[model samples]
Target: MYHTWMRYFTPSPAHHRLGLVCLGVGLQHGALPAVGPRVLDHHVAVVISAGRGWFRGADGRRRTVTAPALLWLTPGVTHHYAPDPDTGWDEAFVDFTGPATAAYADLGYLDADGPVVALTDTATARTAIGRIARAARQGNPFLEVETAAAVHELLVALRRVRADTGADGHPVLQALARDAFQPLSVIEHAARHGMTPAELRTAVRRGAGCSPKDYLLGIRLGRAKELLVGTELPVAAIARRVGYDDPAYFSRLFARRVGTAPVHFREQQCRSVPGGFTDRIPDPSRPPTIPPSAPADDGRRGGG
Candidate 1:
C-alpha cells in the first residue's frame, strides 16, 4: 500500500549487518490528489517541489507554496497540504532520523519548524537523494554515515544559495564568508584576502556598506548568539571561545551590540525559549581576544 511519512527502524538483522542504517530517504509525489492530513514519527520532509498550494504550516501560519520549496517538519507536527486539483506538483523528499538531525538543526539547516529555503537546484539535491536511496536499498553497512554526509552536503548547498547574499563580490568578504562567525579582525581577514588593512577597509565600505571591523563584529555577535542559545557553556567560557577574553568587556560589547547584558541576554533567551549568559572577567593574560596575527597585504580588493 502507498504510504505517506512511513516510519520504520532497520530490523535487528539489518541493524547488525548495517552498523548504522538508522537513517533513510524516500522520494514521494502525487498527481493532483488532495494531500491528506498526516503526521510523521521519524521523518523530516523537505519539499523539493510544489505548485501554488494553500496550507497551514506546523507553525500554524497559513502560507502558499508557488514554486519548489523546502519544508522541514519535525516529528509529530501535523502538516496539511493540498495541491490544485487540476495542476499537480512534483516533489522529491527524503526521510531521515538519527543524532545528526539535531546537528542539522544546530547548524540552522533543520529547525523546530519551517524549511531552510524555498528553492534549490534539483540536480544537486538528487545527488543526495540518490546516495541515500542506494545505500538504503543495498543495505550498506555505512548507510547512516554515507547518508549523513550527503545530508550535510545538501544543507551546505542550501545554505550557500539561500544565505543573506551580502558576501558576494568583495574578495575579502567573500573569502571570509565561509566562517563569518569566527571573529577575525579586519586587518587579519584582509591579509588573508591579500589586501592591506587600509585597502580592506575601503573595499568593505564600497561593497558591504560597512567597515571591515563592523562586519567582523556582526559575525562574532552572530556566533555569540548561537552559542548563547544552543550551548550550556558558561558566559565567560563562551566569551573566550568566541574570541573575547574579558567577560565583563564581552558582556558590554554584546550589550552594546545586542542591547542587553550577557546574563540578562541569556535569561531573555531562555524566556524566549519557544523561539529563537554572563561571567567573571578573567585576568587578561595578554587580553583574551582574537588578535590579528597575520601580516598586512599591499594589494587592493579589485587589483589583480
Candidate 2:
C-alpha cells in the first residue's frame, strides 16, 4: 500500500539561474518509497515534508531525520535514505547554484564527504519550500520573485534552526546572532541586552569567534552584496542603506571584503551571469514583492 510520497524534478536554467540561482523546490511522496542508494550528480538537498527517515552518508555515519527538517546533500556525496516502512515519508527539495551557495558552504552546511546535517524544527522552512514548489509548478511570470522570496525565507528559517541548538555559545550571544539583522549600533545592541559594549564583545568573541562589531559588519556586508547584485539601486543609496554615509568609504570597504569595488562587483556579477540570471520573469501582471519592513530608527523616524 501507500507509504511515502517521493517525487523529484530538476529545474531548468530559466527557472534556476534567471529567477533565483540556487533556488528550486519540489514535493516528494510515495508508498514506502525513498531515494535509493546513490549519489547526486548535482547538489541535491532536501527538507522533509512528512514522516521519518534516516540518511547514511559516505563516512558511514547515519543521521535519523523526521518530518519538518532539512537535509543538505552535496553532489556526489554517497548517501541513502528511506522512509519508515510503516509511516513512510514526504519531502520537498531544491537544487541551486550561485554565490549564495558559497555562503552555505562557508557556514559548513555543505558536506560532500560526510553524513547529512539535519536541521531541526524546519516548519518555517517547509512553508517557504512549499511556496517555491508551487511557484515552480505554475511557471508563473513572476516566478523569480516568488522563488527569491521563498529562498530568503528559507535562509531565515535555517538560521533559526542553528540558533535553537544553543550550542557553541551563551544563550545571550546566540540570541544576538538571531536578531543581528536589526539596524542598531553596537552600544545600543549591548544596552538592549543589559550588557556593556566590552562585555558583549567579549561574549561574542568567546562564543561565536567574532567580535560584535565584526559580526554586525558581516551582516551589513551580506545585505549590501545582495542589494548590489539583486537590485538596481545605486552604490551611494546602498551605502547609506547599510549604514555607510560615504559612498567612497563603502566602496573601499566592499573592495577589502569582497575583493572588488561595488561597481566592479556588480560588473563581474553581470558578466558572470549563468545564462538566464537577468531574464525578466515575463509576467507583467504581478507586482514586485515589497522589501522587508525596516526596523524603527533611534528617534530618527519619518523620512522627508
Candidate 3:
C-alpha cells in the first residue's frame, strides 16, 4: 500500500522578503498519478528518490525522470509528469514562490528551461526537503519562519552542488579579470569572448553575482585603492594609469564609490602609518630585486 503526507501554507508578508516562501510540502510513495499538461502559477520542485517516471514541459519536450533527480516546474509553464505504475516511485516535493526565485534563475542556480536536472548530491537535497516536511507537519506558530529558513538552506545546498560540479562560466570570469582596466564597452568585452552582451551579462552575473560593468569597475577601484596607498603618484597620473582619461571625472567617481577623494584617500592612508607619506610611498627609482610580496601593484584604467 502507498502512503502520502502533505501540508500547505498561506505565507505572511514577511515571508515573501525572505526570498522563499513554502506553499506546500509533501512525501509520497506509490505509483504516482499523472499530473497536468496544465499550467501552474507558482514554482514546484519534485524529487524522485527511487524508481523512474516521465515529465513533459510546455515546449512539448518529454524527459525521463529517474532516481535522485529534480524535476523543476516553473511558474506559468505547462508541465505534466508521472511515475511508472510498475515501479512506484518514492517522491518528495516542495512548492515555493518569492522574489529571489527570479534572481536565482538568472544566476543559473535554478534551471527554468530544462525541467529535469540530475542532482549531484541527492542525500543533501533529501535532507533539506525532509526538514521542510517535518517542520510543516509540526503545526508550530512559526511555521512560516521555519519553512522559509529551510527553503533558504535548500537553495544553498543546490548552489553548493552547482559550484562543486563546475557549472559556472569560468571563461567569462577570466576575460573580465584580464580586461578590467580597459575602457571596453560591455558589448566589446562580450565580443572578445564570442558571446552577446546579454549572454555575457548573464554569465558574469551568475558567476560573480554582479553585472559585468560593475565587476569591471570593482577591479579598477581595487587597483586605485592600492595605488593610492602605495605610491605618491599624482591623482591625475593615478587616474590615467587605471584607465580614466579625465582626472575630474575619475575624482568624482572615486569619491562616490570609495567615499573619499583620491588625494584624501592617500592622505588618510599615510596618516595611519608611523613615519607619514615618505614611509608609505615606495621609491620607483630603485626597483627592488624582489618585489614586495605583501603589496600588489595594478596599472589599468577605464575610460570617461
TM-score of each: 0.48, 0.53, 0.63
Candidate 1 lDDT by residue in tens digits, 153-206: 665555444423331344566766565545466667777778899988777665
C-alpha RMSD of each candidate structure in angstroms = 17.3, 13.0, 12.7
| lDDT of candidate 2 at residue 110, scale 0 to 100 | 49
Candidate 3 lDDT over 222-263, as tens digits, reads 888877887667888878877788889989998998899988
**Which candidate should be chosen as best, given TM-score against the real structure?**
3
Query: Among these predicted structures, which one has the highest lDDT?
Result: 3
User: Could you give candidate 2's per-residue lDDT for residues 1-304 as a string of tens digits?
Assistant: 5533232345465555443354445666654555657876556557676778788777767678776666776666677777787777777677655546655554444445434445656677777777776776544676666666676667556656643344334676766666665657789889988999999987776445567877777877887877778788899998888877888987887898889899888888774423323435646787666699998679967679
State the C-alpha lDDT per candidate. 0.61, 0.67, 0.80
Order the candidates by lDDT, highest first.
3, 2, 1
Say which prediction, candidate 1 or candidate 3, comes out ahead on TM-score. 3
Give candidate 2 regions above 4 Å deviation.
Answer: 3-24, 108-115, 118-120, 162-213, 216-304
